[model samples]
Target: MHDTGDAETTVILDNGGHNIKLGVVGAEGPRLIPNSIVKAKHEKKRVFVGHEQADCSEKFSLFYVRPIERGYVVNWDTQEQIWEKSFSKFDIEPTTSRIAYTDNNYLIPALPDVSNEIFFDKFGFQEVHKASASGFVADHAYKIRRERCACVVDSGFSWTTIACFVDGVLIQESVIRIDVGGKALTNKLKDWISYRQLNVSEETHVINECKEDVCFVAMDFEKSMIEAKKRFDENMIEKRYIMPDFQTSFRGQVKGIREPLASDAPSIVLGVERFAIPEILFNPSDIDIDQCGVAEAVVESITQSPEDLRAALSENIIVIGGSSCFPGYRDRLLQDVRSMLPAEFDVKVSENVANPETHAWQCAEKLLEYPAQVAWINRKEWDERGDSLEYSRFFRTTVTSDELKATTQEFEQKGEKSPKNGEEEEF
Candidate 1:
């Protein structure tokens, strides 16, 4: 704790592709801010950065200038602006405070160089640590359950990743990334709603709100499909989502199918889509995405790890990230994962019931509590170790882009050998 910096002064920034969790280490909770500059259709000339978009009106649609793409910071300028505002909450000058943040598992090789340029040169931060999101989940698991081996299924905004951790250390070779996540789910919901009821293709923010409000993973996809096809009076899964008009309402809300509605009010009727939208995460091929689902990826990651840790990994599986917040996510994931594993092996899947995005930040705080684990690079080390500086000293750095391409191809090849008819009996 002493080596990292003062807990009261240290800043925790869990910079996810969709939302950035920011707060001082001692704060009760982190401020979840959108990680994109928003362009409100009503205010074309004015762009809202981070949480400022909450004030503007999305009359037609809202466009975003996202700093991070595919989980890596691609535009540092946009990121710096968001960071500038987020850091301003703690101090005008972060030159003295330490920072801890999370990144994607399979990161861009050169992303760290540009990130360091921003950390040291642009912002003048004293010390910083970049760890994979799942690594912190592993850290938390080790501390709470004392489970040395665990598999982390992190389905975030951009990518859904499954990685194995043995003794709180990530086995880099066991990391598997899926192309489906919150963004993909949102897009699918948008497409479905556009095709079925309303044209909400341009209404990304509104559609995302609609998705979160009503979407839930179906435990039995076939059963849910049966319910979805039933009459409105007999269908229990049918929901009526009232779209926001921005007068008295802010965002959309899910209402019961029998609920009252005005004649002129705009609304979308959600049927099987409530479960089908989230189905992509379990079976990406449901929407033509070649990647395997979360449960399959989790099994693949654990099986590839050392044989001794596979059982332990199965027993202590943790799913963290935005997509994991869905209502039936845990139950559905546990069912699928258990089905794939041997009947004798114990299987359990869990997520932060309160908030999935903040799990990593909480773990980061706990990780910093033990001084022995603080591997921050201060200005002195950044200056002295010009050529010898190793980014992997703090966390595992992913392979280069070319190597990453090869790994993706390998994933596609392995995806062909999916679990016992994962999505074979689709609706």
Candidate 2:
């Protein structure tokens, strides 16, 4: 994929089990070129990935290949193909620059508990940044200036990650993880529908469709279920949504047909009752997890930090990741957190100003704002060091006070000026 005269860029990739998001960090923002690859069986093999693969699937038998499963990359060969093809689309060169230098760093979330050897060796990233650390770094970028503590509830395709951020940095020890995520939810919903409606085998593509179309988090479990169970009424059903036509080369209308149709497309209810379904984050057991929801996790993490810090934490609750965008998510998360917190605690979720799917990338971009970011490894430095432990120094700064303070000192002494402090540093 290397070609001379193309712009050199920094790549940020998040390898989720459901999808892979990659883009170059730039002035406009992180340019996300989705690597939502998937497994497919075709009569003849012709490589297509990301947008192209999506496009080709319309007229060809090419199957989408999702190479990651349950937060781990299952097929390195396929992943490599996806990355090479996807990055090539942007005209980004592979030749090493100072920015792409051994020190120039490529940041990606190494989904916790997964071996990153292949990612480090294959993707040409000197370092495989931990996803948890990246999440915290992202939280810090938009960290509200606040005295309260807040919890981060990251609900995504493979896992629902819960972590507590005091001020803006993550409390590493307090971080928690749940096996459930959008995938599990989708499967559960698919099982429900298959048992009740369709008897088709669960395919990733079709199940993903069902998830996007029919599945949603329930805020008031019993109440929402009661409402959903009531006899179908057009008033009770949400507006119908039609899947866009992929049959043609052009973008054309795909009308949403209503059910019991002589003409309309089959539709399902979403947001059946206002603020009802999205509340499941606080009450996981309702989904049979036998686990505490995100709100409770925040409280527990905060209490573990210090009972006195609870009020402070609640004031800065930052919700990012894909799941946070579920309608009524913010209101319900805030409400539930408030209920668990002391009467004096103040809870607020960040307002939606951009694509929630890209929040992590946004957070990664915000790292440029830090006044002291020595841990912010550049491509050249990464090459020189070639040491995981050295990188760990930067990683620890994200959550450890001692490391953060040391990093601050290093930045100050290196003559790297800070933007916040009006220095010449170009972090």
Candidate 3:
């Protein structure tokens, strides 16, 4: 790792569809700013960003827009607006030096295999380092806890990526990506509500509200679903959510009403809303995939390591990302891992130390604290490394299964790991 100098402020951007988390990275940790690009419809015109937009959601018919779809920037224009609004919050000029870190999802478009010397030119970031979401999660966890080996199950809004680490560095081949995420779960809720109510617009609002207030992971899916299907009263179902104004005011509170949208619209109950989230981790098949569950994915990722490293890997299972913030998520993850793993394996999840979403950015700040290390990265270095080596070879995996298996075995035997993987892990 290289550093450039005394970074007055390090900007870490953990962009999620649900929330775009930003914070200053320093000696302390990532200072989370609870704001994002999804502005309230009324505030849409103004260059609003960060936590400020969150307060204004109710004022202007808050029309939330996410430029990122499944971890990549699907709409750069909207994303540019989001970044502009976020940067304006600092009250700093456009000339400020910044270190920008983003998830590996960048490989999708903006930072794809194509060599764009203009990336630095366009974004004001003096130093930019992009790693996969799981890689970033593991990197930051290693910094805070000093755990050498672990599996990072990053269940974020758009996608869930699992990454493995050895001695603090990510093993590229051990990375796994799944199509399932909080968005899918939210959409599923949307579908479920639509089936019962027949109104997409109103149902979308309810689904979003339910996701914010009631959604959580279920440690025991079969048992919990049976319980969730039981009847419950409105008093027991009501949840107080602090509503934000999208125009002028900052905050307010409103109880979620499963009230019938129209005279004919079916009323939504809280039990079903809360029950849908955790099901994703256990049943990707619910969304039509025959793949393994998150815990199973973690176990499979760790199995790539040497037998001696299994305990170390299991002990540092750091859960970071937007989806991890759902209520009871950590407990459910830990419980699921415990149920499936050997009795002796130790599995741990990250706490709300630096905000679950920004932990990776905090880790990047620690890495860029030294100016000397920072200056080492230049376009020249990238040019020297070449596209095939710097981007293609690392980001794109087109190898055969037999070759992939051989490589995985080779890494295991060598006690080495990289945050690179084949078809099973395509984050």
lDDT of candidate model 3 versus the reference: 0.57
State the lDDT of candidate 3 residue by residue for 151-253, as single tens digits.
Answer: 7777777788787765445555566777787777777876775666544443344456557666677666667666655554523434433333323424333
Clashes of 2: 36
Which candidate has the top score in TM-score? 1
* TM-score against native, each model: 0.88, 0.71, 0.72
Q: Across residues 329-365, which tens digit of lDDT does each residue of candidate 2 receive?
A: 6776777777877776656665533665666655555
Best candidate (score: lDDT): 1
Q: Which ten residues in a row have the lowest lDDT in candidate 2?
A: 97-106
lDDT of each: 0.76, 0.49, 0.57
Model 2 misplacement above 4 A: 1-8, 34-36, 39-47, 58-65, 73-75, 96-150, 213-219, 232-235, 238-282, 369-388, 397-427
Q: Which stretches of candidate 1 lie over 4 Å from their true place?
A: 1-8, 90-92, 105-113, 351-353, 370-372, 386-388, 396-427
133-219 per-residue lDDT for model 1 (tens digits):
788778666655456566888889988888887556677667888988899899988888899889999999888888899999999
Candidates ranked, most accurate by TM-score first? 1, 3, 2
